[model samples]
Target: MKKNGEMAVRRPDDMHLHVRQGELMKVVVPQTAAVFKRAIIMPNILPPVTSAERLERYRERVVAAAGSASGFEPLMTFKIIPGLSPDVVQELKQAGALAGKLYPEGATTNSEDGVSDVQTIYPVLEEMQRNDIVLSIHGEDPDVFSLDREEAFLPTLRQFSRDFPDLRIVLEHLSSAAAVQAVAELPNVWGTITLHHLELTLDDLLGGELQPHYFCKPIVKRPSDRAAIQRAALSGSPKYFFGSDSAPHPVDRKHAPTARAGIFSAPVAYQGLLRFFGEHDALERIEGFTAVYGADFYGVPKNGDELVVRRQDWTAPDEVGGLVPYHAGEVFPYTVIPGWK
Candidate 1:
């Protein structure tokens, strides 16, 4: 941080993000590349990216959408669905997938094809463990109550820690206190906490007349849970870092009779974080959470260049890509130097 209140830090990675296909991809992917040097692009598309071939095609679309944005790397991933051979795990690694996402069947949008039996994928997990690819788990059990979903998945994470002792795993967008403690105790496990989860609580979503933009899978838990996550994030623990999970759905789908589950924060995630961290006196911790830990966890080199964030006000647009972003219309107290995409 400079005397001018403009801080330059290494360009970061949105370790977990989703930019849906075709036109939507064109609209949103740039929002991420504009700020971060790299992003781990999620694979849960309409016909989810399940193979190296599909991943390659998706990468081309993402690259084209990114359009010569220098060094804006789209680190691709594959969805782990039923009947996917373990042999294909090696191919995914060779194809440059940083991780394989495990979404329990019926967990979230486009996850109907998610694996039902973790046992069925033991061979794949073993191969991933040997190959050193990270396993990104959705960390929810749909059969359980919404708020209890993440807690219920703790045992599964524990089992992975015990069985695949060498496999690196990331518990995505952890929303509960139990999850925070669970990840802390596990040696090979790391957690990615979203900007929305660190800021919003179940109260913000339902305490009033129901703010649909605050809704998301593994729905925001109690305030105590939010505090626990906040502690883990700002405490500067390398075990927990940022992954926006910046999912976007059209505005009609967001505020309809039944709203979709997601919070599109890519457009304002860094600015929002800048404000939140500054308010909490954790400004110095920002780069580590957003940039360093994730790349280190994935065995990639940290981004060399830097981005300057100044203490300037920039209000996010209410609508982006026909979608309502989380915290829509609110004024952020900080601004990225290069400005919004």
Candidate 2:
């Protein structure tokens, strides 16, 4: 083992993450910044980031909130909805958007304003294709049962892939075997696997007493689903990489009546993931998954920066910014020494 069990790699990026807005963002952005060089900030805020101007404003808020955290950057994305103009899509690209995220109507948090029919946003998607903006997908059919939602939405991705052969589409936070296969086997398509989805299953949420924190949109699936995801993560597939999809919710909201659907994994994202990859003996691929591939897919330059991981074991902070983080109160085998500026 390296002295003090320390290893380093090109600094990674959280390809998909949610830092909410206002005060919550202040509380959570640093946790991610502590480990990642950049992250794709989800735009499903209260009103949602639909326009380039709004996206810029949100980016500014996020940049300021992150506050001189070394070289950390927040790559922004816009929420797609019906009737979005091609002109608006161009404006978003000009505003430095890495992609445009699609949330099916009523599918997840603040998605009531999302697309009811995928076709409704074809104009925007077409424009994105022409302009080279990646299309990030929330691959779940709201009408399907919670467990089956992600798989149910696969056909739509297939159709869209065929319809827009040149469009770059990323299936966000895949949660099922079917979804893993779709992204693994499909053409011109890619998928992001979340830490929670890869590690937790329905049983983790309901096996003993109700573990409310385990609940999330497209709720964790079967052990088979998790195993399949693990295979993909460890398979050394170039198409698959890291994206934490670390969505956070306030402790009150997470533990309350009807709870919310998200996991605040930012704080433990690095250490937890390092532990996971280590357990599988797939640690060699960590840098490619966390730092290289997503940047390659997004057409951005890989960060020249690097993150050093110490073999030291540490317990993750129980709460970050007043909200309970994923793996809260749990110990992990590794901790990041966060070197980049």
Candidate 3:
């Protein structure tokens, strides 16, 4: 509750997050674990977590990185590939996979192995549906123009909704007004609004000097799209929830001739969301967007602890884990108070 210049919110759960392996994971996991009680870890690293064995091992690494002090729970997921058997789906469920990520081949980073013909994985999808595992899609058609990719994928998403009537599908990182509206209209379908997508437009990426840091797959779209995302996030709709999609890349990779598509927002996700919601005069709804709704959608309980942010200004770090962070160097209206009881 807001009183005397402090707002206490339920400890959030980042429904979408990417903590890369080894050194990078060590550098970024704490930033998220410090604030979010739990996070759905993305399975798109090199030699992606495609099997139950890999998922278990990756989850261990994430847990080891997060440590016990913060009590961070890494909810694991498997990568969906062609010819994955129904037996493997059961194996993953037994291995603690909360979801499975579907990336259209050539769609994004390390996705060279992603599904080329989504229909080829129908058996796997049907198995996931039976096992009650959520399907998280990167909602873009590789054959379409960059701007039209997400909208172009709408038909496929609609098809999924029809085919797997009971399957819970999350249109990861919603990038357009049409996508946002589709998720709202479809039953058992929800959309994740990333920290970068909620505020960025194509202009932010290339309207003037090219800002490579804002470059991401399903690239941020028009201002109208941004407005629609903001409306969905602020509307306190359970169908739309927070998923930082906080993918991190080294500075050199981001600035390379072929820059990667990701924004390392885990470090500033909570602070940025607090400032955004406060500015919108919807501070009370922040809990649902950041913490409650996502957990409810996953059939998990809300975090019992509260994270208190004070009306104190703090500038975001210019670089986090050797990557430029979202809103780097910009001042935020609120900052998290360490060790909230």
Best by lDDT: 3
Model 1, residue 193: displacement in angstroms?
A: 0.5
Candidate 2, run of 10 with poorest lDDT: 1-10
Please tell me which model should have the higher lDDT, number 1 or number 3: 3
Q: Report the lDDT tens digits of candidate 1 across residue range 1-341.
A: 68897778888889999999878889898888889888999999989888899999999899888878455889999998889888888888999988999999999989889887889999989999988889999999989889899999899999999999999999999899999999999998999999989988888899888988888998998999999999999988899989999999887888799889988999888888888899999899998999999988988998888888888888898877676777778898887877322
Candidate 1: what lDDT? 0.89
The deviation in Å at residue 72 for candidate 2 is 1.2
> Model 2, 183-228: lDDT tens per residue?
9777899988888888999989999898887888879989999999
Off by over 4 Å in 3: none
- CA shift of 192, model 3, Å: 0.5
Worst 10 residues of 1 by lDDT: 332-341
Runs in model 2 deviating more than 4 A are 1-4
Model 3 has an lDDT value of 0.91
Relative to the unseen true structure, what is the C-alpha lDDT of residue 290 in candidate 3, on a scale of 0 to 100?
Answer: 83
Model 1, residue 136: what's the lDDT? 95
Number of residue pairs clashing in candidate 1, backbone atoms closer than 3 angstroms, sequence gap of 3 or more or interchain: 0
Q: What tens digits encode model 3's per-residue C-alpha lDDT throughout 1-341?
A: 45688877788999999999989999999989999999999999888888899999999999999988998999999999776777899999999999999999999988888898877999999999999999999999989899999999999999999999999999999999999999999997999998889888998899999898898888999989999999999998899999999988989998889888898899899888887888899888889998888998888888988888899998889987677887889999898987655
